[model samples]
Target: MNDFSMLPPAGQNFWFIPMEEVALFRRFLKGKRVVVTNGCFDLFHVGHLTLLNEAKKLGDFLWVGINGDQSVRELKGDNRPFFPAWERAAIVGSLKGIDAVTIFTEKRATRFLSLVKPAVYVKGADYTSQSLDQEEKEVLNSCQALIKFIPLYPDRSTSSTVERIRKGSLMAEQNK
Candidate 1:
């Protein structure tokens, strides 16, 4: 078993814990209300920051889970997750609103949600309780974790940003 408590807090490695260590890390959480959120976080954009900050307001600690590289590819296609899992975790974990970060292998967060059993689970307003995945919902129900939706910032998304960058690059090349 990993003695996460012994790990140095000053290192970026401390925050980038494996999902398996959630139970061990619970020892440090004691009485804190933890809010859980998961995403690819490939681009580290404002929308991601807004969601994380809002989620932190709901609980004492915000634990963000970044999907593994393979999982992101499975859900988002081969070109997705412009960054690797560790890189994505490092970027997301650096945010002030985020307390802990974990890398999970599943496409859905069911297992991670079950292990963390956070006080709250958050998603973008793009998802509703009715629209939530049945398996994920079941895990949340069993764990009694409240599900909240943070309204998405207008016209903000990794895909959209990528498209805009691509268009701008094309225009720049045309001018040359």
Candidate 2:
């Protein structure tokens, strides 16, 4: 039960944590509500920050699930994930509203729901309570987590960010 060596280094964030560590994570959530949200997070952007801030408001702690590199490749294709998995994870882990991060390799976050059993399941408003995709529907049906659809911010998304980055039109790239 004691594994100081495996603990994240001082100030170093952990993102791709294992499912076996859920118990330890739950210990941190004891008596406190937990919120969960899942995404590829291929590129960190304003949309992501908005969603995370909203998710944090729904619970005392927020846990974000990032799709693994292979999962992103399968979902987005070969030239996707503009950044590698570790880098993406580190970026997500460092976000202010995100208390913890983990990787989910499955196409759906169903298996993850069974493991985390968070009190709140946060999602983008693009999906409706009735129109949830099959896997998401399953989680809503069996999991104790309540589904919350946060409003999506218009004109701010990873796709748009990636395009901006590619055209050399983004001012942030100039500073980089």
Give me the candidate number with maximum TM-score: 1
Report the Cα lDDT for residue 85, model 2: 60
TM-score of model number 1: 0.89
lDDT for predicted candidate 2 compared with the true structure: 0.76
Q: Tens-digit lDDT track for model 1 on 1-176?
A: 22334334664533666776888887788799989999899888899989999999999988998898889999899998788887777778767778889988899888888888888999999899999989989989997889999999999988899999999999999999
Off by over 4 Å in 2: 1-10, 13-16, 165-176
- lDDT of all the models against the reference? 0.85, 0.76
How many clashing residue pairs appear in each of the predictions shown? 0, 0
Error of 1 at 10 (Å): 4.5
Model 1 score (lDDT):
0.85
